[model samples]
Target: MSNRSYSSQPKSVVIVGAGIIGATLGYHISRRAGMTVTLLERDLPGAGASGHSFAWVNGFGKDPRAYHTLNRRSLDMWYRLAHQLDADIGIHYGGEMRWENDPRRATQLRQRVRQIQTWGYPCRLITRAEMLALEPHLHPGDVLAASLSEADIHVETDTFIDVCLRRACEAGAVVYSQTAVTGFVVRDGSIAAVKTVDAEFPCDVVVLASGVQTTELASLAQVQIPQQQSPGIVMKTTPCVEVLHNVAVIHAPAIDEKHQHLHLRQLSDGSLRIGQGTQEGINRDDSQQQADALLDRARAYLPTIGDARAIPTPVGYRPMPLDGFPVLGFTEAVPNLYVALMHSGVTLAPLVGEMATLEIVDDVRVDWFASYRPERFSVRSSG
Candidate 1:
């Protein structure tokens, strides 16, 4: 959208990784008249980050203003899609609860609620008594209190992804599974096509929603992607007679190493997702040492969680982004190339799809030209 303007005409687009972002983008693109779409993934859709997400759809943990707005937009789409595709997706308005014990933090929490409200997010500050009355099983800590944000809703991630893929197919998009894109055929100022191991898929545009593996994927495409990895570890416990009914969390993740926070949510089938530990590191799979460390951390909150699971799962996702927010829009350098990625993929996937749809399908021009342009890294190389 710089010197080159876009016309509101449909075009052929190729998307990489059929996760939430990719699938949604593919679906939306295919829906537009005169548009053709192709989706490529190394595995079946939703088998990667989208499948293993915490799925705790909340705006509290997100950055206020832009991020919170983005989350809410995605959330609205998530709910709408659930009902629109109810047979294939189940959406639950599981209230998200966050509390703080520190006096200073309690005040700050209330201020945050006000900030969120001012920004149009529905939120309310509740007293300890009110909170306990709503969720009685919570440990009555001797300090501040909790804030109930009804905006948070838990959804079946895999199911929604599958339904989205089906929608994409119904809309006439071709999806290629187990296809690893190795290169981008760049001709003139635009991406002409992408090279996969088995064949070449040509398109007028390519939307890059490669998720955590964006760095490597960008490398193959000869594009410099500004990103980093924020590793997360999550575990699930065998169902109890109901240790907790609603999802509860301590509200702050960066308190201290000794402060292990638990975000517990009950799945549809009565299984409970117990999560607390997140750190920075790389591990393709789980290990004995990681399990032991996770257990010790889980014990710090509810000792029974890790003890019940025995071998807790080691969850991992590198919430990749350029700065603190998502990297989006078409690259200034590569005319037909676009990038979209961030931490709350489940919560923000719909919005990402919408924005990308605006750019690729509707031909709406958005200039990240310098600020959010995906090829900013390439500009540095030229410098």
Candidate 2:
């Protein structure tokens, strides 16, 4: 923790991207004294990946104890943030239910469960009987093992983003929709203003939270933030009778195969959000076919989506780092420019927002984010 204090003068901040990460940061920063914040979005808030996210808030399957701890901390923060936002962001702490069919994969999952348990995470392998008790709707077809984690939570991603943006505006942060960042004004090796297609917004600091487009935006400042983006499809079905009681179910894919898994969760409005865990890039021609396949899989798992129409929703690129972790913190070469980009943006939003505000407003560097600094990718040249 650094003891440096920020200047007493108000800092003008220009946040590029009005997604959940940027919106949350803007909300926190605007609440502080001596700060003027502006959030710029090419479209409306949550119009990017935030709108299309499966939005399962969980720390499970995250590697490196430090990263998992950070996600868990954010999970804890969500409880307070939901109430503080004073809106029904559709936060359901209904936990997550996951299972594997293959014998080898079952062993791997059990080992992971043990590892997470040692880390004090609330996860445990359950017997088939227990699994059925937890989710009677699931068709337990040759499930080798199953695990239940009460710590997991899911949310309505779009609504949550809306709440974050609304709160940010209420806290005095100005938001500009349909304004795209075209370039950056660099003065003495620091960003002086963010140039948009419509106008230039001068600011003392600029934060890049533009999801998959972060790498592109960072280049305007000659900074590198590498990303491995993959197009993902999320299908939402018309409202139906409740099929799942409380838990979101994830069917793990077999070993050696990347694309053939399904994750389904029920929204508060009785709609099912189904995600095809396959990385089959975007196929405009085959989108309806893909959506049909996802709905078929959901029906196979839980016979509840009977005769329901599936709408191919969101379909955005996941903003993942090249190394499969988050790229956060400020760039060393461009000290005034900060970035917050990650795949699990939904799970990490609140905590990242709070910590980022501390770093930007109070000048207190969070030691935990040392590994996730944007400088990590700056060392490598963009291909």
Candidate 3:
């Protein structure tokens, strides 16, 4: 860690992207006394994965102590952020319940539950009777084992982005909507200005928080940040009478290769948000077909959603790194350029913003972020 203190003089910082990560970073950094922040969005805020995310904020499946620890920390940070912003952000801490159908997989699931519990995660196995008692609407069909963790949170991501942006704007951060970063002007091996379609904005530092487009923007600065553009489809239903008991149900995929994993949760407005695995070559017709299929599967578990209609929504790409973890912190090739890209943007947004701001404004290196540096990918490319 570097022993650097916060600068007294204000730094002109430009952030490219107005998604949840960028917006939250702006909000946190702008709260400091000596920072001039500007957030640029090609589209409106939350127009990317943040908008379409299933938005379940939990560290249930994240592995490696460092990654899971960060997520666990962010889970607490979300409540604090919501309190500070005085906004609802649609956060529900009703917890999550997951079960396995196959008897063999149920044994593995029990082992996995023990592993996570040993790691200090709040998860425990429950019988089918207990699972049904917790969520009375669930149809427990041969569920050999199930786990429930009350530490999970559900969010309405678009509202969260809006609240973060609003607070950042209140703190004097300038926001530019529909303005895209076309290129970068580098000087003395450092970013000097961000070139947009209409004009160039001089900045002391540039933070690239763009999701799938992070790779394209980094290339302009001669930095390679590779990302896997995984396509995910989320199906929303028209508002109906509440049938779900406010608990999220996440089921293991069928072993026979005939059923896709199903994750279902209820929104604040009595509508159901159901999602499944990524469909690589999904087209318009295919999207509807997939949505119908997911709904049919959902009906098997929650019979109330059978009458609900599927609303048409565009699919969003998850900005997953090549290794399926986050790529955060500064780049070695470009000293003044920082990148924040990850798959669970919604779950990790607030904490990343707070930590990234500390590193950027105070020049302090966070020891935990050492593993996620962009240099990891650089080493991969050279090898």
Candidate 4:
């Protein structure tokens, strides 16, 4: 760890990745007074984990009161952000509906609902009749217990990322796609510029929001940001008739013991994004057979998905920290090198963007991120 004084207000800021977190942070930082923002992406915007995420914006599965509250705050911030963005932003906001079929899971669902309610989450148990009323198209086999997190919603990450980058560009920020960060130009224990394949971008701060590649990129700056392997797959379907009537997303129970739970959400274009198991579930099977099986199981719940074939998508690797929480704030090894790595990028984009801007532009350490600093990671010598 090194101590180097940084400008209270940084003018040249270089963001390493243009995913949801980087895009949102770019937009926020560009809006600040006298800030020149540059977003660097190796691929097209939203081409990484953000584009393939389940995109369920919620605090339901978050444990610990503080983390749950953090997610809950971001969950509500989406509404304000949508209004502020003043564009499509691809927000479907009818809330998330989930049900459990087995008796054991049903009991657990009820308990979980009660637990979040104590934390003041806008969720409650509802009767099966109410579930049908919300989504009449659902042919749920047996709903032993059901709950609705009224504030939860799903986002079309492509649309959101596009809108954010456009806004950032409009605010005089430059975005370079197909640009990979090759290294960092360090001088006097701080990053003086970020080196890409094409050119070096002079900067006062560098944000590592490069998803699964964050660890390796941070290593270039000699900052230790440990990450675990977390590969996931969320298959897509061809356009079909609108299935979900009122709810933004649905978590359907597994049909049998062989399969895991299924979650789905429909896009404005009438196509559905389907995935099995939990949000953090490990799945790398991108074969057509696996895609077809997921769609078939979805058809069992909503028959309106008629003739909609599944489109196999490549497996996406989430930027999951070893501890399974976010790693935010500037690193002690490099004071100006900020790290913004997290798993639930979709859910926490708005909060991370706005709050990270506060730290990056205003030069203040946000207390909300006090528990999630890069210093928590025990640095290992770079290879």
Instruction: Compare the candidates by lDDT and give the number of the best one.
Output: 4
Give lDDT per model, in order.
Answer: 0.68, 0.81, 0.81, 0.93
TM-score each candidate. 0.84, 0.91, 0.92, 0.98
Per-residue alpha-carbon lDDT of model 2 for 1-383, expressed as tens digits?
43222243438999999888998898889988878899999998888988887888887877789989999999889988887888888787768888888888789889999999999899989888887787787775777889998878888877887878888888888999999999998887888889987688988778998998999999888888887757777788888888777676465453336446678888878888877553334423227777887787778777877887788665578888888788887777877888899988889998999998888877657887888888777565587
lDDT of model 2 at residue 86? Answer: 85
Q: Model 1, range 1-383, lDDT digits (tens) per residue? A: 34333344647788988888898788777877888889999888887777766777767656746666667777777766666554657466746777776777778888988988888787788787876676565554554756888768876677777787788788888889898888888777667789987688887788888888776776665667867766665555555444445543333232454655555665666455545543223444456565555445444444334344534666667657657567787766666677877677878777677677877776666543224556555655554
Off by over 4 Å in 4: 1-3, 380-383
TM-score of 3: 0.92
Give the CA lDDT, 0 to 100, for residue 113 in model 4.
Answer: 96
The residue-by-residue lDDT of candidate 4 on 281-363, one tens digit each, is 99989999999999999999999999999987999899999999999999888899999999998999999999999989888
Q: Say which candidate scores most in TM-score.
A: 4
Clashes of 2: 0
lDDT of 3 by residue, 171-266 (tens): 899999999999998887888899999999998778999999999999999998897658777788887766667565455455356665677777
